[model samples]
Target: MFLSTFFVVFLLGVGQAQPEDRSKGLPTSFPVPHTDDMLFYLQRSRNENTVIYDLNRKADGTVDAGNPINVYYIRFARDGKPWPLKWIERKFAYGYSHKKLKNQSGFQIELVAYDERKIELIPS
Candidate 1:
């Protein structure tokens, strides 16, 4: 009788020690247009100037299946015009979704210089 009781107590203790589900408290929806902001970590390669990272939702702020669309970052020059390049040579920033304009699915991000910012992207 003592052995059986101890075994049951041990099992209960083990169960309690296990970690809780990490996604239980996460948000289900992405940032909304003109009403929300989502930060992202940006990186660049030799061929591409910008790549999106640490985003949980799709560009349209909808649940993504597996493959999400890639949106490149654009920088405007001092002449009040966008840079003309086939691909950005080198660029990196930490930006957040600022607004969702007409015809845009995801929020348009406003990027600044890189920093040690950490963003937790919800997993699909």
Candidate 2:
């Protein structure tokens, strides 16, 4: 009886340790459809010691066709700047379908800065 109880408890502990959604911030595995308009990918470039907000454009000439949407890069030394972009991307990107954004033609966005424990996006 004790052996059976121990086995059941062990299985329960193992199940709790692993989550159903096993995903990470970098290196996305799921293939999401590309958008012709402006699409952004925020990546941590360890070599440059900065974060790269890569704006990728589709084949159409609507967005910046010549370059890789070349929007911007940010170098931050703030106390807690490591994971804000990743957190935003993880929250927004997961299971995000672009069908709703099809009607939107253009986007006007802004980034603001604040001091201490606050994070902001910088353009290169």
Candidate 3:
């Protein structure tokens, strides 16, 4: 019984000793962007710049039927301001296309670069 307990404790200790994966090695000092309509953001180890995804809303505060999400970049490495992606970046990197569901439930989003994984956005 004591041997088994010791082995279990050792395993737990080893697990705790492992370093945590910190946002794919993003710098901890980088400031996280925030906005009222922001849904989420993606960061990369390549640079401090961040990609922001925000809900596109109408004047009445409802989700836009045609364009439901706005994707842009927060250029932290530059002046820390939001900027539209260039044509090349939009075509090859972070651009995405979304389609409203036929069932009127939500929008189906597919990344231009990585289309194998689909993201569904449902408004509350």
- Where does candidate 3 have its weakest 10-residue lDDT segment? 21-30
Candidate 2, 24-72: lDDT as tens digits: 3333332232333334544332222233434445556344423333333
Off by over 4 Å in 3: 1-28
Give the winner by TM-score.
3
- Give lDDT per model, in order: 0.40, 0.38, 0.87
Candidate 3, position 3, lDDT: 100
TM-score, one value per model: 0.22, 0.21, 0.71
| Residue range 1-124, candidate 3, lDDT tens digits | 9999999999999988968776785666767898999988888877889999899899998988788888899999889999998898878888889888788689999989899999989867
Task: Indicate the TM-score of model 2.
Answer: 0.21
By lDDT: ranked, best first? 3, 1, 2
**Candidate 1 local lDDT, 12-76, one digit each (tens):** 99988968675664444432222132233233322223333334457677734342223334331
- For every model in order, what is the number of clashing pairs? 1, 0, 0
C-alpha displacement of 3 in model 3, angstroms?
Answer: 60
lDDT of 1: 0.40
Better of 1 and 3 by TM-score: 3
